[model samples]
Target: MDPKEFGEFVTAWCPGCGNFAILKTLKAALAGLDIPPHKLLMVSGIGQAAKTPHYLRCNGFNGLHGRSLPPAQGAKLANGELTVVAVSGDGCSYGEGGNHFLAAMRRNVDITLLAHDNQIYGLTKGQASPTTMQGQVTKAQPLGAPSNPFNPVAVAIAMKVGFVARGFAGDTELLLDLMQQAISHKGFSLVDILQPCVSFNKVNTYAWYKERVYRLGEDHDPRDWSAAMAKAMEFGDRIPTGVLYREEKPDFAARFPYLAHGPLGKQPVDRDALREVMETFA
Candidate 1:
């Protein structure tokens, strides 16, 4: 399908909304991959980030609050042929669904997770999110966020996720490249996009990000875990944006040799055997 097909689904976001750029970039990346629309599945949880699935014309699942990863993983396990992508906001992924995030990474499921790192909970009228910088004033944290923000890249690296990357919404081309790479990667891929909430978050605005964000170019080695960790730590003055780390580790499906033949959903089950199993439970 053409980009226009997906473009029609996007409505008016706030002026200079970073999500718009991200959506456009994602569409371009999908087009470049030349994958059939039917083969792609976009899943999301409750938040402004969840609205992305609705805005995209591709097959999508709008799931419960902070529960996008579970269903996405289920879908991948059931039908390995489909390309699964789970999208969520910082609060949805890093805050409320933190446990799920850790588990999914450990499992190393074949899926892509795109986090809209706006640093604040936009849908909830500007509450400080898990990634919201310390000392950043918000509606919930009037005196500024006291605790340190969750460093997603570092955490993912620590978890030994197969693929980990960071991008900025303003740079659509770069973001698209990262998305393409993440989707193609075999195991769990986390692409944290530094998005700006035009309406609610005034701290990490477009101008503010432009001043600090820098891309890790061709010379940067994504395979170097130590270097990637060092780069991930440098976020204040010079925020490095690109693939932080990548390793060709076995996915959860691969480790479980039984699933290697084909997807469980596509495999036929014997009615007689199933009946016998059910009778034992009964």
Candidate 2:
């Protein structure tokens, strides 16, 4: 997958949007992994971030709002050989799709979820999203968010996801590395990208993140769940980036004997094939 071959169209995102950086990082990651566009399937829920698949030259499913994971899981179940990646905005992933997010981790699905956590709903105008800081003011929450911002990394680490990490959209190099690692992992992998919504989010801007975000220490052990959770919890004063936790586990496909034949999608499908199965029932 050459980086040049990934994008088939120009992006529609606002100039200086963090999504631009993420898009570049993803292309580089896929290219580094040598996974061709035909072998990849990008599933996305409705949002500015969801448009990522449209820009890339790959099989893409523009799923309903907050519904990227279900199709991603179904696609993977049918064709476990496909490199499945789910992308969504903070509101789409953390707010409307929060339940699916949890279910994926619990099911240990073999897929990579790249969450664009920009702290605001960029696509729907300026609104406070699930990851928005409590004090942040938005059009929908003029007074303030009131509730604490959801902690995706902490939740993933506590649930024992196969791979959990965080990345900064500003740091393309580090994000590319994290995206590759997540895609390479066998089971559920979540990379919560700290994205800055230039137009919608005035707070938590690039400079704000730059001042707070730092790479995880080399001594930091990803296998240590306790240490990982602690790292995930660190924010405000300092934010840790990189793989927080990772451990191998039986992926959804491996747990099912029926999927041993490889992706069912690759098998022949026709009225004759369907009728043969119906005749067997008789």
> Best lDDT goes to which candidate?
2
Candidate 1 local accuracy as lDDT? 0.90
lDDT of 2 by residue, 130-191 (tens): 99999898888889989998999999999999999999999888999999999999998999
The TM-score, computed over Cα atoms with residue i paired to residue i, of candidate 1 is 0.96
TM-score of each: 0.96, 0.94
List, residue by residue over 150-204, the lDDT tens digit for candidate 1: 9999999887788899999988878999999999999999999999999999989
258: Cα error in model 1, Å: 2.8
Give Cα-based local distance difference scores for all models.
Answer: 0.90, 0.92
Q: What does the lDDT come to for candidate 2?
A: 0.92
Candidate 1, position 105, lDDT: 94
**Which number leads on TM-score?**
1
RMSD per prediction, one decimal? Answer: 1.3, 2.4
